[model samples]
Target: MSARNAMAAMLDELMGPKRNVELGKDTKVTFDDPDICKYYIVGFCPHDMFVNTKADLGACPRVHDDNLRLEYPKSDKFEKLGFEREFLKFLSRLDEDNQRRIRKNLEKLKANEENGQKKEDLRKLRDEQEIARIDGEIKLCMAEAEKAGEEGLVTKCQELVDKIEQLEKQKTAVEERLNNTATIPPPIDESAIKVMEVCEVCGSMLIKNDAQCRVEEHLSGKMHMGFSKIKVTIEELRFDNGSRGHLLMLLDISVNVKDGDHVNETDHVIEIGEGGLDRVHEIAIVAEVVRATDIVGMIVIGVTGTETIATDDIVAK
Candidate 1:
């Protein structure tokens, strides 16, 4: 059985049937030992593998039982409205101050939506008034055309009629949109938190909070800060243009490398220089070029290695 299932089985055997409990509240459970994972109390335990491996007792059984009973917050109802789990997790990770800020932002979003609806109603009213005015103009033009018996007056009356029809069609479309907006719930703005940044090291998009909890969590994450000692080297080499002058070079070498042919093949090896240096560094094919026109006869490459490649170093393949 998998470690997760095994743990579940163990919990069932120890705690009877799984029952709900209110989270963030003290539970009545008796334990002989005091060494327990605090994260397990809230139901997020990252060291489950260690427990299955018998490296340690994992999380205290009582804590796990208590977590299973912990009640989810009422705001979690947003999940039913199609709010993503990540968004829910983001909200939970926020401190009390940030949570209040998020609530305020949600109110603002609703207010903005209401204001927009008012503007749309006003615009629709104006369109209706314009349509009424156009109808009067068309009637006047038609009477003038009949009195004068002129082709020019008749054409002017026809143009006025067409303009009124167009206005009516536009007003109908606006009315439909407004009705739909009133009936359907608006989508929650993911960017309502306001403070957001992309991690430079891993390119992970992170949202910030007033308490800086999210930012600190992201920066301290193992995936984000794990490669601190790793370095990449890229060598740029320029070849003579032959007869096309310096502007038209035969080859433009960059540190970045991409191989379209072996994109799906994970076992392929990339060799650098004529010497066939095997264990160079990490090579990632960030993008695939299906058309030759995209590269313009020049290869694009990005390299990550032990040492930073300098412009003076000549890298040949």
Candidate 2:
């Protein structure tokens, strides 16, 4: 049921014919006697007698004064009506005071918020001003140096220029460090050169390639030579008879020897061997390529302007 209906039913039940105590004349009652007057006032029984004794019904007694009896003839029958009127009057007094305090507190809170925003704006403006001041100071320093015609002034400008260059280099280095990481290739097994015994009489080192010095029991008998290997991705492989097949093959690749034993290549392709049994052809396989980005390290070749081969026919030459 709704609260209004529930309350009305409860009031009807209390003031119903059962406990028949009606006020026909102005009655004298005390807040202390809650047991007799409890149901008439609050529509409930006092659960705890101790709490009932401590509780005070702080209603204005002026409304219940006997001298005011001639005003309302029905007031004598409803003493609760007078108590409620006096309670509303008490609340009105507090409501006025609360309104003034609420306005003052709200204003103070708004002022503090605006002040904080102002401080933040001022801080941002100061930062801008500081940057402009530094620029201005640099220009003024340069102008003064030019006017004075002193050699030390030019040196001071050079120092500042060097510092700026260092800062620029540091920025570029940091950017690159963030962008890339070094990847070392896993090591492969290889034989090392044997070490020769010293000539006993002269304490001279012997050549490792000599027959007598090429012993496994020597201190450095195994020599490892690290060479770059290339894997060829071939689209069509043809033999002397014109038989064609697709192949993927890896060969030990090297640069073509030049004047000072330096390897040189303008493109990725490499012709590995001459017309002999031990000869082999090695080709560099490009992994990927982009039109705009600069290639770094060994260029990654991809299937650009090139055909891809089938996988099954690769042979070790």
Candidate 3:
């Protein structure tokens, strides 16, 4: 329809087969077509440019750098001009009806050029029609192949069916798992395990077993709510008989109050380190302590941040 398009159509009619043959490397030419030259010749694929310094054309280039010029076979003394021959062969075999139609349109286009209509528009229409014909032929070929149950065609269909069945099975399994998990209530009180740490020094109510954290402060920096710890310290305090009560009590840290409770600032219960010298640091705890006589808690404190740190026995101070 458009002038440029019409011109391309005319060019294709005259040159399409020649071009295809040239691309097939049947016919030899001193110079490559400008468009093909731009891609295959001037533009160098980065990968090839990097490794192969040779001028030989490989399958493709490795790199995609913009600066590289394309390398093409352009020599005055060339051997195989098969490209041009092959192109001419294809062009000669072009559909006779299409060719006649093209010639008629071309004549009409020439007449119209004199009659005030642009020649370029006619050329574009002819090219578009030719392309459409080719496209239709290709579509027919594909449909025939599909109908005949070609190997790849059947394989592709089977693959798609298998994929769909797999997806359906996965969906069913996931749904079943969700239903089963739903039937069993998620642990209401189990999630606090990571946030739970018992003080080895104070000998908290936690059942002590591993001697790795004995007679030392539980180096758990801070436990989340509902996690408990026992803090213990011996201070030489002058009591009524010249002896202090030696306040050694296990502090149970928990979310003891709900959000609306009076002491609820984020609802965390305040037990130890709230008032008096029973403050957090002064306890002089054998950090990370357990009831074992041999092990200490400070050992855990030494390697706290590691995920799978092995515990060692605490050396009594």
The lDDT leader among the candidates is: 1
Report the lDDT tens digits of candidate 3 across residue range 145-237: 565466567766555555545545654554454445344344576532222223322213232353456323333422211022111011111
Clashing pairs in 2: 191-223, 192-222, 192-223, 193-222, 193-223, 194-221, 286-301, 287-301
lDDT at residue 317 of model 3 (Cα atoms): 39
lDDT by residue for model 2 (1-317), tens: 46776554455344432233555743434332322332224221112211312222232111122222333234433333333223223333333333444455556555755775686567556545655555565666556655544656666667666655554565455444434423212236322123333422112234447665443333332110000000010111111111100111111122232332222354323222322222112122211111211323222212212332221112111
* Clash totals in order: 13, 8, 51
Taking all chains together, each candidate's TM-score versus the true structure is 0.24, 0.27, 0.15
Q: Candidate 2 — which residues are off by over 4 angstroms?
A: 1-81, 141-155, 162-317
List RMSD in Å for every model shown: 21.6, 44.9, 41.4
Q: Candidate 2 overall Cα lDDT vs. reference?
A: 0.33
The best candidate by TM-score is: 2
Any runs in candidate 1 off by more than 4 Å, and if so which? 1-94, 150-317
Using lDDT, rank the candidates from best to worst.
Answer: 1, 3, 2
lDDT of 2 at 156: 67
